[model samples]
Target chain A: MKNLLIFGVGLIGGSIALKVKKDAIFDRVIGVSRHNGRSLDDFVKKGMLDEIAVNVEEAISTANFIIIATPVAQTKNILKKIYPYLNADCLVTDVGSTKSEVMLDAAESLGDKFDQFIGSHPIAGSEKHGPDAADEKLFEGKNIIITPHSQANKVQLDCLWGFWECMGGIVSSMTPSQHDEIFSTVSHLPHLLAFALVNLINKKNSKDQLLEFAASGFRDFSRIAASSPEVWRDISLANKKAIISDLTLYKKEIDVLVEFIDNSQEGNLNDYLSKASSTRSEWAEDKK
Target chain B: MKNLLIFGVGLIGGSIALKVKKDAIFDRVIGVSRHNGRSLDDFVKKGMLDEIAVNVEEAISTANFIIIATPVAQTKNILKKIYPYLNADCLVTDVGSTKSEVMLDAAESLGDKFDQFIGSHPIAGSEKHGPDAADEKLFEGKNIIITPHSQANKVQLDCLWGFWECMGGIVSSMTPSQHDEIFSTVSHLPHLLAFALVNLINKKNSKDQLLEFAASGFRDFSRIAASSPEVWRDISLANKKAIISDLTLYKKEIDVLVEFIDNSQEGNLNDYLSKASSTRSEWAEDKK
Candidate 1:
């Protein structure tokens, strides 16, 4: 029986456990979390796992596979607590938004004792969070990026990919730096923009009036601004350099657009329109 | 028997006509349009309309309700052409995004006959255009703003509201100026922002690379920018003053955010996040 133990069993880890339970690959599944542990009860109620461990050491003592799914800032501390009980052959991976910071933490805590520690991020989430919001198909058809350092072994990497595949993600691989740079623009900077716009609107002293008239445009534009402040604050600090660069680049671009709108020259309007249309059209085609 | 003459039988007009037909209200429904009039055939073949008329004068003669759903710039010319056929009692409304400009055009073209016109903007649409994309439920649970000049009668207003209610929209009355000012922020500016963002992305020489890496964030942010450029160009021009003002306001707001990020003070981050959360939470509650 292949033993699987999932740590920090919130939305991502709990979801992975649920998907893995659908198959006969794991004979025993265990979850370890620091919360009220209602998720464990819910998981059992849903038949997602066979057992729950009250502590990290007990969770990893007999596990063949371990997945750390916690906020990036919390992973390092949890890794230290579980290290003493982890087997030398226990394959390990994590689901953290920022790979570089978490990678360093993994190195410090897991060292060479663990079989492998691969960094992974599934680019799927919503404004809502928590284990109750967990969907077994959360990662299905979504992009899963894995960043394995030089020390990672092929056997462990293959097994990690097998786990992610079982969870319904289309797996891809990138270096930590590449992941940070790309997501900074595609995710982090956009969230910052939404938050900034919402703040500006609120400062107008017509927040209630504006809310009364808030249409679909404002709703969709600022949806991400409603995301958990703690998560974004951590992300904003962790990916600060890349996010700052992307934000600067976007501001400069918006300034150029402001110039064209102010001038109202038919030529500039047409130019912007054609460029925007072609770009959005191309992007629209690539959606999975 | 209410005779309904719908001009520019495109998505909005066709959908309204279909809804009215389904309710079995209008005694006669006729569609008038240009562009080879292919959409009119779909409406007639689908039994949404009783017949089609090629000329504005022919369609408007002896009609009780005239709905103008053409582009804002073209609306004036159509009104002028049909002015001779329109009776003093005939009620006129439009489905244009900008109300003030269209109202002005109607006032100029009709002079003494201007009393017949009531400017309207139904805030429901998809990026997809044409009658083929039209659905009977397009306006269900949507807001329709009716902007009437002082000359509009209560009977005419109530009848117009009744028509939209049957088509499944909550009707609200406002002045043309208010409609223009409010939508300039809520709808027009957002579309402009999306367009501008898309144009900026396209300017990147690494277009293909960006598109390949484009995730859900970029896709949703740029969705509105993918709308028809021809339609947007007219809207931007029609509501030029308000949209330009909004653009300026947005630029200033964004600049403040940029400065805050440049400073990188923790206090500033908290301020931005707090203000945004407070406003967005209120807005979200209003939406519910």
Candidate 2:
């Protein structure tokens, strides 16, 4: 019987467990908790997992598929623990925001079995976390990116694509570098800006009073600032090079805008804002 | 009979018309369209306005209360137009995002009648616009800030407070400079950042490709970027000093974050993000 062993059954992993059980994709699904297993109890009570694996070695050895659904920082340690016990045909994949770093961690930790691993990022998440926040339909129609290294096993890569597809994700493949660059621009930079915006307000002498008047615009713009500190810290570090590059470019954009406002260049400022506004409006329209 | 004459029957004006009509707050509500009367047509047909003003002079002459809900750039011109015809007791107020500039405009245009004018900024709006997007419940439980000049008539100020309170607004008073400073930090800065971010993406060679993968975090964070160019241009210019100061402060925040990320200051970065995350979390929780 096929076995699916999931590491760190929080929002991402717990959702996967729920979906897998509903679809019966694997004969037995086992979870290994990263925390104190208090989060895992809900999944157990709900019958989302076939078992909570008490023995990591036994679970890894019997598993045909292993999914590492932990923070990027924990991926290397989890990879190291499972590498010795992994069967020859076991396909290992991880759901980490930054792929290049995770790819490096897998290469370092898995050694000879590195080809069996592929990096996946299901671009679906909420400010909320833990198993209690897991939703079975979280990945439905969401973009799930897979970043496979040059030495990745062709058969295992195909299996990884099918695995995400079966979870109702729109799966696409890209190189680890491409994945990191794209996400750094689209995701990492925005998160950093949000955190900084919140921190800027937090630093103000009138912070509490300022926050009291923050309306829907601030609410939506700062929503991502409420994301997990540890998770974002891991992402920020793992993808530092690309993120820093984007941040540098973004700072230049801000400086240009400031110059426009500073000089009272009404026409130039209007044109700049018009371009941004029209582009955003079109993007929002297209989203609908 | 008490008449409420509203200039620019768009989102803000139309919403005010709706609330006033539903509550029968005035004997007659008349609308003065800024554009062609096309947008005002639905409002008249829906019985939200008793009449669309045919003669600007007559409308101004008979009005007991005049609400200028037009864009900030047009406020000077609207005030200039109605100044000659305004009766001595006619209280004039505007719903502009920026207070100091609008206050200046009223001071310039109204001359001896300056005390009759009070600047009001209702801190409630949607990304949507025009009369069709108007809601009677728009001001329900929302903060309505009135920025009254020191020389302002106390009776007119009290009446203005009563007017907004009648429409279900929670009214508060502050000076024009204080209003500009508070909103500069909370609203204007966030908007400028959102616009700049969208423009950054627009400048990228892979704009469409990057936008395709921009998920919820990017979506929510950039939502304010879709605001009206003309409106934001007016706000940015009107509140230039405050906005620029905030932007400079925000840029420093960005620099600090970039330095943390660039040097791989893991502990410092984590602490910075944790503070933002926790502050945002507590604010969100309190909001609920």
State the DockQ of every prediction: 0.45, 0.89
Q: What class would a CAPRI assessor give candidate 1's docking? A: acceptable
lDDT of 2 by residue, A1-288 (tens): 999999988889989999999999999999997654465666787898888888889999999999998777888999999988999999999998999988888999999999999989999987678788888899999999999888988888889999999999999999988888889988988888999999999999989888888889999999999888888888888888888888889989999988999999999999999999898888888877
Provide the TM-score for each candidate, comma-separated.
0.88, 0.98
Judging by lDDT against the true structure, name the best candidate: 2
Q: Residue B104, candidate 1: how far off, in angstroms?
A: 2.3
Model 2: CAPRI class: high
lDDT by residue for model 1 over B198-282, one digit each (tens)? 6655666655655666677666666777777777777887788888777777767766765665666556776677778767776
lDDT of 1 by residue, A1-288 (tens): 678988777788777887778766688888875675454676777787788776657668788988888776788888887778878778888888888887877889977664468888988775557677777888988888999888788888998887788878888888888888777766777678778767656666555555566677777767777777767767777777787777677767666655766677666777777778876876777663
Candidate 2 stretches with Cα past 4 Å from truth are A39-42, B35-42
Residue pairs in candidate 2 whose N, alpha carbon or C atoms collide under 3 angstroms: none
Per-residue error (Å), model 2, residue A66: 0.5
